[model samples]
Target: MMTNILIVDDDIHILNLLTIHLSKDGYQVFQAKDGVEALDLLQEKSCQLAVVDVMMPYLDGFELTKKIREQYNIPVILLTAKNQIEDKEQGYAAGTDDYLVKPFEPKELSFRIKALLRRYDSRADDSVVRIGHTTIDKKSYEVQTGSRTILLPLKEFELLYFLMSNPLQVFSRDRLIEQVWGFDFSGDERTVDVHIKRIRERFSTLTDDFQIKTVRGVGYSLEAKRS
Candidate 1:
Protein backbone atom coordinates (compact mmCIF):
# COMPACT_ATOMS: atom_id res chain seq x y z
CA MET A 1 0.00 0.00 0.00
CA MET A 2 1.26 3.47 -0.83
CA THR A 3 1.79 5.60 2.30
CA ASN A 4 -0.28 8.77 2.33
CA ILE A 5 1.32 12.01 3.54
CA LEU A 6 -0.15 15.43 4.12
CA ILE A 7 1.88 18.57 3.47
CA VAL A 8 0.58 21.75 5.10
CA ASP A 9 2.07 25.11 4.22
CA ASP A 10 0.71 28.47 3.13
CA ASP A 11 3.51 28.74 0.60
CA ILE A 12 2.54 26.95 -2.56
CA HIS A 13 6.19 26.55 -3.43
CA ILE A 14 6.95 24.68 -0.23
CA LEU A 15 3.93 22.44 -0.69
CA ASN A 16 4.99 21.70 -4.24
CA LEU A 17 8.57 20.99 -3.24
CA LEU A 18 7.56 18.57 -0.48
CA THR A 19 4.93 16.95 -2.66
CA ILE A 20 7.39 16.43 -5.48
CA HIS A 21 10.03 14.86 -3.26
CA LEU A 22 7.62 12.73 -1.22
CA SER A 23 5.70 11.62 -4.30
CA LYS A 24 8.94 10.63 -5.98
CA ASP A 25 9.73 8.50 -2.93
CA GLY A 26 6.44 6.57 -3.56
CA TYR A 27 4.26 8.29 -0.97
CA GLN A 28 0.73 9.37 -1.88
CA VAL A 29 1.07 13.08 -1.18
CA PHE A 30 -1.68 15.54 -0.25
CA GLN A 31 -1.36 19.27 0.25
CA ALA A 32 -3.18 21.91 2.28
CA LYS A 33 -2.76 25.66 2.50
CA ASP A 34 -3.23 25.85 6.28
CA GLY A 35 -4.10 23.92 9.41
CA VAL A 36 -7.85 24.18 8.89
CA GLU A 37 -7.60 22.64 5.46
CA ALA A 38 -5.27 20.00 6.76
CA LEU A 39 -7.70 19.09 9.50
CA ASP A 40 -10.53 18.88 7.03
CA LEU A 41 -8.56 16.57 4.78
CA LEU A 42 -7.60 14.43 7.78
CA GLN A 43 -11.28 14.00 8.62
CA GLU A 44 -12.02 12.87 5.10
CA LYS A 45 -9.11 10.43 4.94
CA SER A 46 -6.26 9.61 7.29
CA CYS A 47 -2.62 10.29 6.48
CA GLN A 48 0.36 8.26 7.62
CA LEU A 49 2.34 11.43 8.43
CA ALA A 50 2.23 15.20 8.09
CA VAL A 51 4.82 17.85 7.18
CA VAL A 52 3.59 21.20 8.48
CA ASP A 53 4.85 24.77 8.24
CA VAL A 54 5.08 27.10 11.25
CA MET A 55 3.80 30.32 9.72
CA MET A 56 0.29 29.75 8.43
CA PRO A 57 -2.49 32.31 8.33
CA TYR A 58 -5.33 30.88 10.46
CA LEU A 59 -3.43 28.15 12.33
CA ASP A 60 0.27 27.73 12.92
CA GLY A 61 2.28 24.51 13.05
CA PHE A 62 2.45 24.31 16.85
CA GLU A 63 -1.30 24.46 17.32
CA LEU A 64 -1.87 22.15 14.39
CA THR A 65 0.53 19.62 15.91
CA LYS A 66 -1.39 19.72 19.18
CA LYS A 67 -4.65 19.29 17.37
CA ILE A 68 -3.29 16.36 15.41
CA ARG A 69 -2.07 14.70 18.59
CA GLU A 70 -5.47 15.10 20.16
CA GLN A 71 -6.97 12.49 17.84
CA TYR A 72 -4.32 10.94 15.61
CA ASN A 73 -1.44 8.66 16.43
CA ILE A 74 0.39 9.76 13.28
CA PRO A 75 3.87 11.24 13.03
CA VAL A 76 4.18 14.98 12.48
CA ILE A 77 7.25 16.87 11.27
CA LEU A 78 7.29 20.62 11.73
CA LEU A 79 9.04 22.24 8.76
CA THR A 80 9.85 25.77 9.81
CA ALA A 81 12.40 28.58 9.83
CA LYS A 82 12.72 28.63 13.62
CA ASN A 83 15.79 26.74 14.80
CA GLN A 84 16.31 28.06 18.33
CA ILE A 85 16.41 25.68 21.29
CA GLU A 86 13.23 27.23 22.65
CA ASP A 87 11.50 26.78 19.32
CA LYS A 88 12.44 23.11 19.16
CA GLU A 89 11.29 22.69 22.75
CA GLN A 90 7.98 24.30 21.88
CA GLY A 91 7.55 22.03 18.89
CA TYR A 92 8.17 18.94 21.01
CA ALA A 93 5.81 20.22 23.67
CA ALA A 94 3.21 20.70 21.00
CA GLY A 95 3.50 16.97 20.16
CA THR A 96 5.51 17.22 16.97
CA ASP A 97 7.36 13.96 16.29
CA ASP A 98 10.22 15.71 14.45
CA TYR A 99 11.47 19.22 13.64
CA LEU A 100 13.18 20.41 10.47
CA VAL A 101 14.45 23.93 10.03
CA LYS A 102 13.74 25.82 6.83
CA PRO A 103 16.04 25.70 3.80
CA PHE A 104 16.42 22.02 4.57
CA GLU A 105 17.56 19.64 1.88
CA PRO A 106 14.68 17.57 0.51
CA LYS A 107 16.81 14.48 0.96
CA GLU A 108 17.20 15.23 4.66
CA LEU A 109 13.47 15.69 5.04
CA SER A 110 12.85 12.40 3.25
CA PHE A 111 15.17 10.60 5.64
CA ARG A 112 13.42 12.06 8.68
CA ILE A 113 9.99 11.36 7.29
CA LYS A 114 10.89 7.73 6.62
CA ALA A 115 12.48 7.39 10.06
CA LEU A 116 9.39 8.70 11.81
CA LEU A 117 7.10 6.48 9.77
CA ARG A 118 9.16 3.43 10.66
CA ARG A 119 7.94 3.73 14.25
CA TYR A 120 4.41 3.04 13.07
CA ASP A 121 5.41 0.11 10.91
CA SER A 122 3.99 -3.22 11.96
CA ARG A 123 5.95 -6.44 11.94
CA ALA A 124 4.99 -10.06 11.39
CA ASP A 125 5.97 -11.16 14.88
CA ASP A 126 5.84 -9.45 18.26
CA SER A 127 9.30 -7.99 18.90
CA VAL A 128 9.74 -8.88 22.55
CA VAL A 129 12.93 -8.97 24.58
CA ARG A 130 13.53 -9.65 28.22
CA ILE A 131 16.42 -8.47 30.36
CA GLY A 132 16.14 -9.91 33.87
CA HIS A 133 12.60 -9.10 35.04
CA THR A 134 12.06 -6.22 32.62
CA THR A 135 10.23 -7.12 29.44
CA ILE A 136 10.07 -4.84 26.40
CA ASP A 137 7.43 -5.34 23.71
CA LYS A 138 8.45 -3.23 20.76
CA LYS A 139 5.27 -3.97 18.88
CA SER A 140 3.13 -2.47 21.63
CA TYR A 141 5.71 0.03 22.92
CA GLU A 142 5.18 -1.22 26.47
CA VAL A 143 7.70 -2.18 29.12
CA GLN A 144 6.66 -4.71 31.69
CA THR A 145 8.49 -4.90 35.01
CA GLY A 146 7.33 -7.27 37.70
CA SER A 147 3.56 -6.83 37.90
CA ARG A 148 3.48 -3.33 36.41
CA THR A 149 3.69 -2.17 32.83
CA ILE A 150 4.67 1.29 31.59
CA LEU A 151 4.20 2.83 28.18
CA LEU A 152 6.96 5.05 26.90
CA PRO A 153 7.04 7.96 24.52
CA LEU A 154 8.38 7.06 21.08
CA LYS A 155 11.99 8.30 21.32
CA GLU A 156 12.59 6.92 24.80
CA PHE A 157 11.15 3.58 23.80
CA GLU A 158 13.33 3.42 20.69
CA LEU A 159 16.45 4.30 22.68
CA LEU A 160 15.70 1.70 25.35
CA TYR A 161 14.96 -0.98 22.77
CA PHE A 162 18.15 -0.26 20.82
CA LEU A 163 20.30 -0.39 23.94
CA MET A 164 18.67 -3.55 25.29
CA SER A 165 18.94 -5.26 21.92
CA ASN A 166 22.71 -4.70 21.96
CA PRO A 167 23.29 -5.18 25.67
CA LEU A 168 26.74 -4.11 26.91
CA GLN A 169 27.69 -2.58 23.58
CA VAL A 170 28.42 1.06 24.34
CA PHE A 171 27.03 3.53 21.82
CA SER A 172 28.09 7.15 21.50
CA ARG A 173 25.54 9.95 21.47
CA ASP A 174 26.21 10.59 17.80
CA ARG A 175 25.79 6.92 16.99
CA LEU A 176 22.55 6.69 18.92
CA ILE A 177 21.19 9.76 17.18
CA GLU A 178 22.16 8.43 13.79
CA GLN A 179 20.71 4.97 14.32
CA VAL A 180 17.57 5.98 16.16
CA TRP A 181 16.67 9.39 14.79
CA GLY A 182 18.18 8.75 11.35
CA PHE A 183 21.47 9.98 9.84
CA ASP A 184 20.12 13.16 8.34
CA PHE A 185 18.51 14.40 11.56
CA SER A 186 19.85 17.89 12.29
CA GLY A 187 19.33 17.71 16.06
CA ASP A 188 22.46 17.60 18.23
CA GLU A 189 23.68 15.30 21.02
CA ARG A 190 21.49 17.00 23.59
CA THR A 191 18.53 15.18 22.10
CA VAL A 192 20.03 11.83 23.09
CA ASP A 193 20.75 13.07 26.61
CA VAL A 194 17.18 14.24 27.11
CA HIS A 195 15.65 10.95 25.92
CA ILE A 196 18.14 8.92 27.99
CA LYS A 197 17.26 10.92 31.09
CA ARG A 198 13.56 10.26 30.58
CA ILE A 199 14.07 6.56 29.98
CA ARG A 200 16.27 6.24 33.08
CA GLU A 201 13.73 8.06 35.19
CA ARG A 202 10.92 5.80 33.97
CA PHE A 203 12.79 2.53 34.46
CA SER A 204 14.60 3.48 37.67
CA THR A 205 11.82 2.44 40.01
CA LEU A 206 10.69 -0.53 37.94
CA THR A 207 13.76 -2.72 38.31
CA ASP A 208 17.45 -2.66 39.10
CA ASP A 209 18.14 -5.86 37.16
CA PHE A 210 19.14 -3.84 34.11
CA GLN A 211 20.85 -0.45 34.22
CA ILE A 212 21.59 1.95 31.40
CA LYS A 213 25.11 2.97 32.29
CA THR A 214 26.90 6.05 31.07
CA VAL A 215 30.42 5.13 30.05
CA ARG A 216 32.22 8.29 31.09
CA GLY A 217 33.92 10.06 28.11
CA VAL A 218 32.52 7.30 25.90
CA GLY A 219 28.76 6.90 25.59
CA TYR A 220 26.13 4.58 27.16
CA SER A 221 25.51 0.88 27.58
CA LEU A 222 22.70 -1.28 28.96
CA GLU A 223 24.03 -3.76 31.50
CA ALA A 224 22.02 -6.47 33.18
CA LYS A 225 22.93 -6.33 36.85
CA ARG A 226 21.86 -9.75 37.99
CA SER A 227 21.35 -9.85 41.72
Candidate 2:
Protein backbone atom coordinates (compact mmCIF):
# COMPACT_ATOMS: atom_id res chain seq x y z
CA MET A 1 0.00 0.00 0.00
CA MET A 2 1.20 3.52 -0.76
CA THR A 3 1.89 5.72 2.26
CA ASN A 4 -0.40 8.72 2.50
CA ILE A 5 0.99 12.06 3.71
CA LEU A 6 -0.98 15.20 4.36
CA ILE A 7 0.69 18.59 3.86
CA VAL A 8 -0.94 21.74 5.16
CA ASP A 9 0.15 25.25 4.32
CA ASP A 10 -1.44 28.46 3.06
CA ASP A 11 1.30 28.99 0.51
CA ILE A 12 0.51 27.55 -2.90
CA HIS A 13 4.18 27.32 -3.74
CA ILE A 14 5.03 25.26 -0.69
CA LEU A 15 2.15 22.85 -1.38
CA ASN A 16 3.23 22.38 -4.98
CA LEU A 17 6.84 21.97 -4.02
CA LEU A 18 6.12 19.29 -1.40
CA THR A 19 3.64 17.46 -3.61
CA ILE A 20 6.18 17.19 -6.39
CA HIS A 21 9.00 16.04 -4.12
CA LEU A 22 7.01 13.60 -1.97
CA SER A 23 5.32 12.08 -5.00
CA LYS A 24 8.69 11.51 -6.60
CA ASP A 25 9.84 9.81 -3.40
CA GLY A 26 6.88 7.38 -3.81
CA TYR A 27 4.42 8.84 -1.29
CA GLN A 28 0.72 9.57 -1.84
CA VAL A 29 0.45 13.21 -0.79
CA PHE A 30 -2.68 15.12 0.20
CA GLN A 31 -2.75 18.93 0.42
CA ALA A 32 -4.74 21.20 2.70
CA LYS A 33 -4.80 25.00 2.84
CA ASP A 34 -5.22 25.38 6.61
CA GLY A 35 -5.73 23.52 9.87
CA VAL A 36 -9.51 23.23 9.53
CA GLU A 37 -9.19 21.67 6.12
CA ALA A 38 -6.44 19.41 7.38
CA LEU A 39 -8.66 18.16 10.22
CA ASP A 40 -11.47 17.52 7.77
CA LEU A 41 -9.16 15.57 5.52
CA LEU A 42 -7.93 13.51 8.47
CA GLN A 43 -11.46 12.60 9.48
CA GLU A 44 -12.30 11.62 5.93
CA LYS A 45 -9.11 9.68 5.25
CA SER A 46 -6.14 8.01 6.92
CA CYS A 47 -2.61 9.26 6.38
CA GLN A 48 0.60 7.78 7.66
CA LEU A 49 1.88 11.24 8.62
CA ALA A 50 1.25 14.96 8.48
CA VAL A 51 3.55 17.91 7.68
CA VAL A 52 1.91 21.16 8.76
CA ASP A 53 2.78 24.86 8.73
CA VAL A 54 2.45 27.13 11.76
CA MET A 55 0.82 30.32 10.57
CA MET A 56 -2.55 29.37 9.11
CA PRO A 57 -6.07 30.73 9.25
CA TYR A 58 -8.89 29.10 11.32
CA LEU A 59 -6.48 26.72 13.06
CA ASP A 60 -2.74 27.12 13.51
CA GLY A 61 -0.18 24.33 13.35
CA PHE A 62 0.21 23.92 17.11
CA GLU A 63 -3.52 23.54 17.67
CA LEU A 64 -3.81 21.26 14.65
CA THR A 65 -1.01 19.06 15.95
CA LYS A 66 -2.79 18.73 19.26
CA LYS A 67 -6.01 17.70 17.58
CA ILE A 68 -4.19 15.16 15.41
CA ARG A 69 -2.47 13.62 18.41
CA GLU A 70 -5.76 13.24 20.22
CA GLN A 71 -6.85 10.73 17.59
CA TYR A 72 -4.13 9.42 15.28
CA ASN A 73 -0.93 7.52 16.10
CA ILE A 74 0.84 8.97 13.07
CA PRO A 75 3.82 11.30 13.30
CA VAL A 76 3.43 15.06 12.81
CA ILE A 77 6.20 17.38 11.65
CA LEU A 78 5.68 21.11 12.03
CA LEU A 79 7.28 23.25 9.29
CA THR A 80 7.61 26.89 10.15
CA ALA A 81 9.89 29.94 9.91
CA LYS A 82 10.05 30.35 13.70
CA ASN A 83 13.31 28.77 14.79
CA GLN A 84 13.37 29.96 18.37
CA ILE A 85 13.90 27.36 21.10
CA GLU A 86 10.74 28.57 22.78
CA ASP A 87 8.81 28.07 19.57
CA LYS A 88 10.16 24.55 19.19
CA GLU A 89 9.29 23.81 22.80
CA GLN A 90 5.75 24.97 22.20
CA GLY A 91 5.53 22.81 19.10
CA TYR A 92 6.55 19.71 21.05
CA ALA A 93 4.11 20.61 23.79
CA ALA A 94 1.40 20.66 21.13
CA GLY A 95 2.13 16.97 20.30
CA THR A 96 4.29 17.42 17.21
CA ASP A 97 6.62 14.45 16.76
CA ASP A 98 9.22 16.57 14.95
CA TYR A 99 9.94 20.15 13.86
CA LEU A 100 11.56 21.55 10.72
CA VAL A 101 12.41 25.15 10.10
CA LYS A 102 11.35 26.80 6.87
CA PRO A 103 13.67 27.10 3.83
CA PHE A 104 14.36 23.45 4.60
CA GLU A 105 15.90 21.18 2.02
CA PRO A 106 13.37 18.88 0.37
CA LYS A 107 15.76 16.00 0.87
CA GLU A 108 15.99 16.73 4.60
CA LEU A 109 12.21 16.82 5.00
CA SER A 110 11.90 13.52 3.14
CA PHE A 111 14.57 11.96 5.34
CA ARG A 112 12.85 13.07 8.55
CA ILE A 113 9.55 11.69 7.32
CA LYS A 114 11.18 8.37 6.57
CA ALA A 115 12.85 8.21 9.97
CA LEU A 116 9.70 9.02 11.95
CA LEU A 117 7.61 6.51 10.01
CA ARG A 118 10.17 3.77 10.56
CA ARG A 119 10.37 4.47 14.28
CA TYR A 120 6.60 4.38 14.76
CA ASP A 121 6.26 1.20 12.72
CA SER A 122 8.93 -0.51 14.80
CA ARG A 123 7.08 0.28 18.02
CA ALA A 124 3.81 -1.08 16.68
CA ASP A 125 5.40 -4.25 15.36
CA ASP A 126 6.62 -5.30 18.80
CA SER A 127 3.39 -4.82 20.68
CA VAL A 128 0.24 -6.92 20.97
CA VAL A 129 -2.41 -5.96 23.54
CA ARG A 130 -5.53 -7.84 24.59
CA ILE A 131 -8.52 -7.26 26.81
CA GLY A 132 -11.43 -9.63 27.42
CA HIS A 133 -11.99 -11.53 24.18
CA THR A 134 -10.69 -8.74 21.99
CA THR A 135 -7.15 -8.99 20.70
CA ILE A 136 -5.63 -5.84 19.32
CA ASP A 137 -3.04 -6.39 16.63
CA LYS A 138 -1.24 -3.10 16.72
CA LYS A 139 0.94 -4.04 13.79
CA SER A 140 -1.97 -4.61 11.44
CA TYR A 141 -4.43 -2.14 13.03
CA GLU A 142 -7.09 -4.75 13.75
CA VAL A 143 -9.34 -5.96 16.55
CA GLN A 144 -10.35 -9.60 16.79
CA THR A 145 -13.01 -11.22 18.94
CA GLY A 146 -13.31 -14.96 18.49
CA SER A 147 -13.58 -15.51 14.73
CA ARG A 148 -14.97 -12.08 13.95
CA THR A 149 -12.32 -9.51 13.15
CA ILE A 150 -12.98 -5.88 12.47
CA LEU A 151 -10.79 -3.14 11.10
CA LEU A 152 -11.14 0.14 12.94
CA PRO A 153 -10.54 3.71 11.94
CA LEU A 154 -7.36 5.21 13.35
CA LYS A 155 -8.90 7.15 16.23
CA GLU A 156 -11.31 4.42 17.26
CA PHE A 157 -8.61 1.76 17.17
CA GLU A 158 -6.23 3.83 19.27
CA LEU A 159 -8.92 4.73 21.77
CA LEU A 160 -9.96 1.11 22.19
CA TYR A 161 -6.41 -0.10 22.47
CA PHE A 162 -5.56 2.49 25.11
CA LEU A 163 -8.55 1.67 27.27
CA MET A 164 -8.05 -2.07 26.92
CA SER A 165 -4.36 -1.86 27.77
CA ASN A 166 -5.29 -0.82 31.27
CA PRO A 167 -8.50 -2.70 31.79
CA LEU A 168 -10.72 -1.52 34.64
CA GLN A 169 -8.51 1.50 35.18
CA VAL A 170 -10.62 4.60 34.78
CA PHE A 171 -9.26 7.36 32.62
CA SER A 172 -10.87 10.73 32.90
CA ARG A 173 -11.85 12.40 29.66
CA ASP A 174 -9.12 14.97 30.08
CA ARG A 175 -6.52 12.29 30.70
CA LEU A 176 -7.81 10.16 27.82
CA ILE A 177 -7.63 13.17 25.55
CA GLU A 178 -4.11 13.86 26.77
CA GLN A 179 -2.81 10.31 26.89
CA VAL A 180 -4.73 8.51 24.15
CA TRP A 181 -5.12 11.48 21.85
CA GLY A 182 -2.06 13.50 22.76
CA PHE A 183 -0.90 15.50 25.76
CA ASP A 184 -1.24 18.62 23.63
CA PHE A 185 -4.85 17.95 22.64
CA SER A 186 -6.79 21.23 22.96
CA GLY A 187 -10.21 20.27 21.67
CA ASP A 188 -13.42 19.66 23.60
CA GLU A 189 -13.41 16.71 25.99
CA ARG A 190 -16.48 15.59 24.13
CA THR A 191 -14.25 14.20 21.43
CA VAL A 192 -13.40 11.36 23.77
CA ASP A 193 -17.09 10.75 24.33
CA VAL A 194 -17.72 10.45 20.61
CA HIS A 195 -14.97 7.89 20.07
CA ILE A 196 -15.97 5.85 23.10
CA LYS A 197 -19.53 5.76 21.86
CA ARG A 198 -18.33 4.47 18.54
CA ILE A 199 -16.38 1.65 20.18
CA ARG A 200 -19.40 0.62 22.20
CA GLU A 201 -21.51 0.52 19.07
CA ARG A 202 -18.99 -1.57 17.18
CA PHE A 203 -18.90 -4.23 19.87
CA SER A 204 -22.57 -4.08 20.74
CA THR A 205 -23.77 -6.97 18.61
CA LEU A 206 -20.40 -8.61 18.36
CA THR A 207 -19.58 -9.46 21.95
CA ASP A 208 -20.98 -9.70 25.46
CA ASP A 209 -17.75 -10.47 27.26
CA PHE A 210 -16.47 -6.88 27.46
CA GLN A 211 -17.82 -3.38 27.66
CA ILE A 212 -16.74 0.21 28.33
CA LYS A 213 -17.93 1.67 31.59
CA THR A 214 -18.62 5.35 32.13
CA VAL A 215 -17.30 6.57 35.46
CA ARG A 216 -19.68 9.51 35.36
CA GLY A 217 -17.72 12.43 36.81
CA VAL A 218 -14.50 10.68 35.91
CA GLY A 219 -14.19 8.98 32.47
CA TYR A 220 -14.32 5.48 30.98
CA SER A 221 -12.96 2.01 31.58
CA LEU A 222 -12.93 -1.31 29.73
CA GLU A 223 -13.94 -4.32 31.76
CA ALA A 224 -15.40 -7.80 31.55
CA LYS A 225 -19.16 -7.84 31.51
CA ARG A 226 -20.74 -8.77 34.80
CA SER A 227 -22.58 -12.05 34.83
Query: What would the TM-scores of all predictions be?
Result: 0.62, 0.60
Name the top TM-score candidate: 1
Please give the distance, in angstroms, between residue 99's alpha carbon in candidate 1 and its true position after superposition: 1.0
Q: List the residue pairs that clash in candidate 1.
A: none
lDDT (C-alpha) at residue 168 in model 1: 89
Cα shift from native, residue 222, model 1 (Å) = 10
Query: Where does model 1 exceed 4 Å of error?
Result: 122-129, 136-207, 211-227
Q: What's the lDDT for residue 124 in model 1?
A: 21
Q: Per-residue error at 122 for model 1, in Å?
A: 5.8
lDDT of 1 by residue, 74-190 (tens): 899998887799989788767687999999999999999888787666422339878888888987899899999888888888899888877889888877886588646898998
Number of clashing residue pairs in every model?
0, 2
